[model samples]
Target: MKNIVILFALIGLLVSCSDEFLEKEPFGELTDGQVELPENIESLVISAYSILNGQGNEASNAFNSPASNWSFGDVLSDDAYKGGGGTGDQNQIHRMEIYNIDGQIIDVVQKWSVLYEGVYRANTVLKALKNTTDFDEATKTQRVAEMRFLRGHFYFELKKLYNRISYTDEDGNYLSNTQITPEEIWTKIEEDFNAAIAVLPETQADPGRPTKYAAWAYLSKTYLYQGKWQLASDAADEVISKGGYSLTPNFSEIFIPENDNGEEVVFAIQYSINDGSPSNYNGSIGDRLMPPGGPRYPAYGFLRPSQNLVNAYKTDVDGMPILGNVDLTETDNVDPRLDVTIGRPGIPYKDLGINYEESWARDLATYGPYGPKKRVISANHPDYLPSWPYVTAANYSIIRYADVLLWKAEAEIELGNLEEGRTYINMVRERAKTGCYIQNLEGTANAANYMIDTYNDPFDSKEEATIALRTERRLEMAHEGHRFFDLVRWGIAADVINTYLEKEKIARGFLTGATFVAGKHEYMPIPQSQIDAGGKDESGNPLTTQNPGY
Candidate 1:
């Protein structure tokens, strides 16, 4: 057993020094007094977890190094636009949104530094644990597993964003040219998660910590991204059959502060407020993207949902999307998730009882007339500690049960089990059927004509099932930061995004010449700062080769 009492003694010290890991020299010899004790070793582990929120970095702005993937994953895809004052606001992101990104953008460099900084912190924990002799074997093993799980997650994000990345660990030298292939990177990520699964318990006392099943779900996701159908299917099945996770009864409750870390949450980033700290480390990036000048708190309107995404909610009488149809009228039958996912005009913006209006938007002409609803907290919430009225105590869900189910469905369909895939898809759609609609303050009527239905018949063919899976994922997880990555993984980003831009140009004038170039735009370029820092090999050759066409 571990010494819990000793562990708590160093928790505050660890959190206070988390950001220092990025600047601390890993190769510097540590004195025996630094991390030789059990309590100090445990503090290093806690420090690793503290950086998971991706905050407190002085190298970049909060919007650039946000924990949320809204900039690249949503705005860069067909799901959203880089909405702010105009095309020039946060112009680096706007450039990325329109496929004009370079290797020198601050956002790219900041994100790269933040993720690598996380890897460094995790490595520090592992290294300290290896050297510590006073810790119990069981506690040491569990902490090792936890650190590796965090390391794997950070590398996984780096891999998806930049396919070619340098590998590092506690024992490994910093900025070394490892020359690992993409396949090899995926293998390393899988190994970490597998090791985590082997040692982690089924349940954790703290909900923020990863459990054995969280490792399984993430392993499944890694496989799905790499097109390993059978492996993905098996891993997902392990979570489904053994992981005791289920869909939250209501979709709206999934994002609310009170229901955070609930039954549906497989893993989430824990955030706290009013802890006598000036830093907004616990505040989520979503808080910064709220619509501006509302009766409620003021917000910076970034990552506005695209019209194509808004139109995607339009469903037929049977709860099926009007595929290939982009024009949707307000009176048209639409999926109930629309209201839950977005704040449209004339709808109540939450329990505030004030209706959302076009005036809520910063500039309707530049972006669109929509505001994200998932991350906004009610002013009346008990945990409402609004620093500058843009920070909140909302925990961000990184992996949820619904995401696992969808991945399983994707794997099943890819493996030729069309009917099985349809069953999983409908499971999500069914849960979304109830409590998905937003109603008026009196609760007498729905704000909009909300409608949704599950697939009653088996998929006719694999092609049709694939399309249904794609559309379902778009509607179910829209604006949650999965759109661009999904498209890239499916090898259809070029087709889907180009088509979206072509159609959207007519409605949103800012995207008149925006284009998504294939091969080059699939992954972001390695930041020029990283290249300048350590781009060369021992032979003076470019070790960190930039992405093609950068």
Candidate 2:
């Protein structure tokens, strides 16, 4: 494993060589022995983050492009729903039937390939570091831990979306004829995370490095997927108890750049426009999804919020949106997070002036009651953008303290510690209200709304409580991109999503051609190319079993 670190350092050394050698770049063709210098290895290791970029880039704004279509399928198809216009290419997502192959091969299949490629690279680093003699023992151990953490994280994505995913070895090759069951893959992921927990330092020594707590946070999620409630609870608790993380008083500040690196974030994807290219799609998620043809110029508000979700926000104590108990309008102060979570068309952006003209050709709208407002970013002004007040690059939170606390609450409830569970839930709620950025939970009534009766008991029955918890998870994590994964893990995608579709259609008054397929559609259709490469299952059939329906 240390050999991998040494290998990277070697690559960096070579990269620093004379202009001719650097420009000509003979290393790709060179033998390992020929290019075994310290600098080359370092360059290669540093390049691994680019592989992650393949999962999300600047053009798509991390919203789920062609690569993240499964995320959209798992979410928009049934658990949640949205309808918008794009060219056939763009509209495919709206219709929930997106699949296309491009000339460069950079689509969903490529993303899957690249994720596994990342795994192979990390494994190579781990194996090299294990055998390297030149690196210090401490450095070797830490490096191995980093690779393991990365490897586990990659596999976690595949397992969640695709169910059974193929594993690879150190040399960027998949194990032939190997098909790991979902449970077996979880076991492997746990093993990798556990190894990371044992060896990673408690704090990061550099940007993007994994820490002991990062390992624990990821393992907590892994355990939850595997149905190990106690273990998941304990792992999250471990991070909360001593990891030096805490909830930020203001939930919005966590997203704003001026307040980044706060207590709430455990691990976040680092972004810098001046340092390099901003994420290709991540920088544009909001604008890409904005409503089309409105006063808000150049915005294509894509992620439209459902009226159902908008109504979910109970009114202020006095029952007004921005004020008390008045007839709520589209723009209400019911839950400030609703604006922060999902943007509605009629809602004023506060910053938009009469001079602004929105770009609807790209599906952006600034006026009228039609556009989505969540996670919209401005290349010029970030004070209004969720990611930050000044930064162009939106930091995607991979793990955060708030999630751990919520998980603690859920696990405790499932374990039958109702009081303890409520305590954890309240901790999150209290922070929301008292934290400088957010208003009173019920708005200026008790100052601590959770202490009051209205917002206190989220559900009537234990089953209802579970549903409430899941809903909270969905709302809290929306657009940070966790909703789809949560639905799939619980195997509730079909029912939840199809219900949403019917509601969407009913709301929009569309009667005919409304479709909801259950069972296999809950899981994504396997990429056609993968089936082509692997052939069929037992019956010598095409792998396009279609999950139950087309």
Candidate 3:
């Protein structure tokens, strides 16, 4: 949390509209004393939730700080390309795509800023709630709990992306970046979530508010990241057994605007396309660059799926993954999720009238022809906006039920509970098997040799189960922005990415010498600007030390 968090608040509102309200200073604003009222303080809690979508009051490019993590998570991984007009369009991302990211990059700066803004807002609520007198005791505690949940979320993202980030709360708001140890940062994140879980309700009247299970799901993920296998599995079990969430039967329907907060979503950043903010800032603005150009929906065709990702879908006769040398030629069978996840050359684009053609892609020569599908709302839907800012009311889920189930599987496998893990993995696979299959232009038959099946269980070695679990997670969460961090945590980033580059270079020449350096490239550097402004240590050096090679 920073000392610069605004102290004023308006009653009964919390969102992008509040961005405008918060910007108004001195004239026609409530006094700092007036803001201590119960309703105004409650409004502060809601305002904390607004920053989750990555838009600050400024009109700067929100795509650079996209809550979707498309640029850092997907493009930096083997899953996507910095797709658009050419290599020069949003070139900072191009440098990021090739693993040549620098501390001065716009994304490096803005992402750090936006996440800290979230922290600031959350801490503001926590600080203000402590002073309010008229608010109901239980309600105040509930608001405090929600703020902690949100604060925990922001720090979790920072830890994952930067590895060792500064930790803060209202109590120690101005602590230097190096004040906490790496282990202490994780402990702080756990503390926030654990505190929230003790008070947050199982259900909220508002869909946007995270419930107890949401905190538990995140705690499970936090433990998984740190390799606390038993704790991770136990946390995941709490969500699975008690959260009452299920896999949305139709995988394709999950991303649709109407189902944005459906049963599958454990917690999500709620986005509203026409939310009365003149600029549509409350919409998923950070992902504004993702909509692929086509006859029906025209927008920047960025976040293009990579050829390597498409090939990973290839399956053998038993509907199992065929690891290396995945031959996409000869009508080879591929997982059905491939069609549900990526818009290929011949598939009907999200059930819109026209088929996806090569012309739909902005640069066929450079990025190749595969537009991302998971986050894209159908052009035919009413929420569709054929313009800027993540363009739809479709909420970006921070944690999905399937994701929690997989976390359990991953933890179980790591904990040597192979059979239990296999069952959990199969639950997600079973949904894909029976739920949906991509159909042809007329919606007559399977689009591509769709052949996906569940894995055979029992007595399999941890190695085989681990492979199956990792493959399932990649296929399920491909473009929603979890791939790169997953690879890094598994300690296989260097091997996986270098191999991907070696083969991928044959098709996309831009990746000729790209390499994922072991210790350094796993985490992005602390922004140069942050280091300059973050004050100094006792020895007259910058307080924030740069991550390894940076």
Candidate 4:
């Protein structure tokens, strides 16, 4: 990030050039003192938020550093597949899906680059705030709080994806990656959120801006990641008891473009289309490759739902998750969320009035026959861009109310409060059971055997409660990009993912060599380019070190 921001000073230095430089105001041509002006400071803060979609004034290359983390989060997990033309299409991602990942991969470098770019932008705003004077004191404090909130978010992503990233702040303090511990990095993340919480307003006129409740939600998540059970639970309780967020009536309705900023969303990346931009830069540029190729939604098909995730949704006669081996290829009584989350062969997809068929999926022989349905706006909607590089205006929520409920549940279970945990789990289940489910093509019949029920009774023990909690989280949060991380955080990544690859390879032959190594694969290998460029040590080695087993 420091390398990318090349600040230059001019003393009327000029080079004669062609007459095609737009003949307009140059981008970021401000002097250092002018950058600290009140208006420019406000623009810089907005600039920090602009990177949330992971685009940087370009129309392409978004797949490399999508803020959604679809590549690292969903494709790396058992939840989805690298479903494009074949194994060779975007083959780097194929290498990731098969666990042949290398530190030299583009995703490793670009994702790291974009996140640090976010940190740099946030710090730039903070630095400008520290020097500006004409700004109102109250508003200055709020903007400072907002920048810290964003910096915390960026560092949180860095901490989870990279584990031990270099840390820097507005006051010019820089801690090398080798010099900082993951625990210290986590502490820094918490400090930023605490600073934000101390000054932010309870609400904002602009829906995308963080509120006090948003900071609390993020803090709860940070504590949950660190296993601070009591602190995590308390922070979640603050949101639940005081935050005015709620679940929308229908499970499927929450994702449509109309509800992008609906009640359930706590913090989201704002996106829009047809807002007078030369391209769909303000749209879901990162997720352009995700739309399933169908008559209604015509686009590249990537991130197909894995059959393992489909099997996880199967229910028994009592609407409880079937813990035993149910045929991974077939479906029986299942939760309604399965249809809402994934597009299967015979289901009526959205409001298109046609059934999703095996023909709709690309590279079906390699990736199998399923497409992601959640967070995918209907092709007929105005928010979808129909031209080349199809994108959408639908927003992506970084934190949602459902996530808060589940965090509290997990903390409760870990703290030995099984009944309290079950109650929270039941709340999520009850919404799926009673909410709007997938209807038939004509809207006259039911789709699949929708048989979902809540956990109305007590669990026999903590082990049983823990299993229930994890399963409910998977079902409720499918394809929203929380599957693999959930498994890793619980320390069962090796067991669960290896078991998945074993069973799934039998159905899809392409997964023959995929493996998940516990100590090494828990976090991605640090980008080799970063290590090479990250200064030097006394022994002439790169200062930044790689994660274990890299």
Candidate 5:
């Protein structure tokens, strides 16, 4: 595959021109004659990788189609709030947060467009590879595998967001609206990943490229989401036993610039800074996530962590979560991850050496007291480019080894391997216990009485293990944007989110009447723009149907 630098340069040219003249075709687009050359084919494959950051054109920020999914996966769930200037400042996201979304929302339309746009790019590469005969058979097979992996990832995102979607391939032919079921989509996704696995190497020469192990990890997750316990467990086992991946010693280290593609990262979106491009394509979403106006950090303050999520970190005397207990006391022990994930009162904020004050919040009355810490980089850090200070160079991990272990535990428990499940869960918990605690600037004391202990005994039943797994995942993956989807896959989005809204409404008055309607709110409505645009079939019927609610 071609490097990201070349890909980025080529993407700018590709999206601009679409004329039919074969002699003047853009560098990014491949004509029938161009596909026969190995170099041109490689560039096409690299173009597919370039859109991983969701940047199609340079004019607007790709907020709706960000690789992070912070809006859809985190804010829409209990993990965060749509915190900006106010509810009016990205009301569509707020509507999503409050379960008041519709088909006409621009965020919905952009997200749908960008993802399908990704599918189109991947299909382009696949088509080119299929037609090329100048390359060696070995190279051809490998390139095909890589393209499939990219396509699988794009489809997986669509599958998780909108349960019922149209399916398409390299020919640009899509199934009639809602013709495919979620299970069928899952099967296709699985097939793509499996094909990638057959030819991908265990490790890639380039850091951003996916490997066989990355495919395995994703395949395992795909199966886990579908409740295919045995398949999920086996796939996870293959990764754990042979993938050679390990957790980063410090949880806080995972997000820093120096650890861009660390050992803990299974796969991550590669980002570069000072790449001579004024476009924020290489910059991270963290630029917008900084506290609205702080002494050092300045940002829009979106995706604020919820008080319920903050409270969920509270632990009992035994270093376990204070489950079923709402009355949090000063003496309540809590997981260290709370400090690592969120910025609250009196804690050192993102290596600034100054405590995060409640006054730093844009509007405490509307959003909350907490701000997201996981994505913010210290202004003092060397990677903090003055050119675009808001857009840091932090690479966001799509899958980490810790995520794999947790999924493994979930699958094991579901498959009746209770003790084995406990072992995997504890491995993650044990890793969390060490080198993860933040400390005072003086380095003389723990940040917030941090304490986290592993489960010493076997879970009494699968339900017990399930609760532990769910809570562990929330605390482990908090602001990284996996909470909502996890809740949906567990079939408990309604209960978990409604209960969350009830508590949150009392704290953040903006969520006064918020409620998660079970069946309908589980998936977002299909974009109206897509429906209006070529969403109809041969009989003039709508090819793209709206989701049940809107």
Candidate 6:
């Protein structure tokens, strides 16, 4: 626990908020005499947790979060859907077909800056743990494990976003300003996760702390990105086979406020109104996504589900979601997951007892579609007093067993073990009632009720199976910030993204719209301020060029 103290001191030194908070310098002035070695270590670790979750609000709620903005690039470039924004207008995303793209570039830059700020805090905590002399040996080891887990987690974000980034030393110094290859960064990431796995406990006595299973799950993802097919598969399998984690019987139970800290969640950032102050970051993003005055009954929702994403769900033909090869206009029959994932008009709202009539109406006259219910609590509601800062009941899952299952499938496929890969893929599809639903149409029960083996989808080739596995990922993990990177790793960013844009033009009647060209504006440009301030270039630029084209 002394290590916790060291961790706290390090966080106090490194993890300050924006410029305004830093100027006040609440943490820096503390003397050694005032530092409580063991008693305050918990507070320091808590501080780190606060920093990590700080962006969840802006990212998940505001819809302005970097990864989500970048994800727009994905849908725009694909055949899925399109919005109404014309070139340089509010519908700028819609203008992608016309080759007008400058706003996206700006979003990329902002995400990069915010993400780096997160990395800095993690790095600081890590460095502090390394130098602290106050902690005992065992406590120090556990603290180090936690720090490494955090560092690797942040690096994973960097990897997903930029594909390549520089590694910072213990003192927050860049060991190499030059861009390391993705493979190289993966090496460091793999190393950190492995270390974290070794040191983190299997289950934490505290709610928000890291555990052994969490480390394993995170490493599994890193391996997936590295194309270490076997490693990724094995790590995911490890979580299931040995990590003592399980799928919660009911999906809604996983999200319920009371069920938080339930057995199924391996790791989630615990948000409590009582534990210190509530983070505005933890406020309800789901409510904010709703159209204004859409449904105060449910809460502040603003983000409308794209028609394309909604269409991914298919009707249960024989108890499975048969993939429909229809135009975007057809929505009479769709997959159950669509209802579970995103709300749509005309879908019966159990809570509201009303059906949304217009598919595209998302205004005051037509309340937002009621499918994917926003899980966050609203502050403006009558129950929430002004003194009681409004907060959502959100336990953001950094890792989940479903992802591990998908990772395992990908690994087996890449290893030339198609049969093993099929097992994992079918396991997921079986649960979703996808493909040949003949086995479980009732849709009333959990995994046990579904009989998935009746329909066997064997891959004709490794590539075929790989595509299927990735497709499952898209459906399974959409709106969770994994789609953009999935495109990058497949080397399909240019092809997939551009196709989406063309599809939107044809479907939305926005032909001559914007196009998402790769290489030219794939990743975000390095922040201009960082460049002017002499920040180390994570992109390995010669400091002359502005990332190919500004």
Tens digit of lDDT per residue, candidate 4, span 27-59?
Answer: 256766887888777777777787777765354
The reply for model 1, stretches above 4 Å from the true place, is 1-24, 27-32, 56-60, 173-178, 285-287
Q: lDDT, candidate 6, residue 216?
A: 90
Which residue runs does candidate 4 get wrong by more than 4 Å?
Answer: 1-27, 57-59, 328-331, 539-541
Query: For every model in order, what is the number of clashing pairs?
Result: 0, 71, 1, 0, 4, 41
Could you tell me the lDDT of residue 126 within candidate 5? 83
Residue-by-residue lDDT tens digits, candidate 5, 326-426: 74555668888888899877888877778888888887888867888887777788666544446767788999999999999999889888889889888
Off by more than 4 A, model 5:
1-3, 15-30, 285-287, 290-292, 325-329, 387-389, 535-540
User: Per-residue CA lDDT of candidate 1, range 429-516, in tens?
Assistant: 9998875578887788888887888889888899999999999999989877789999999999999999988889988888888888
Candidate 5, lDDT over the whole model: 0.79
RMSD of 2: 7.3
Clash total of candidate 3: 1
Candidate 2 lDDT over residue span 1-550, tens digit each: 0011112233333322221110223234445543333443445555454344433322343334422232353234332334344333344454442222221223334445546656655665655554455666776677677778888988887676556566665544443223545677888899999999998888775645768998999999898887788999999988989899988876656766554455777876554343323322223232234433354333343444445555555445542222111333533446555555544433334234311222332332211233334444433454223332122444456788989988887887788776667677667666655544323333343221221111365435566556556656655665565766677667786566555655555545432354545555444444455555655668776532222232
**Residues 367-422, model 3: lDDT tens digits:** 88789787888877777776655477788899999999999999989988899999
- My TM-score estimates for the predictions, one after another, are 0.94, 0.77, 0.94, 0.94, 0.94, 0.77
Clashing pairs in 4: none
Query: In candidate 5, how many Å is residue 513 off?
Result: 2.2
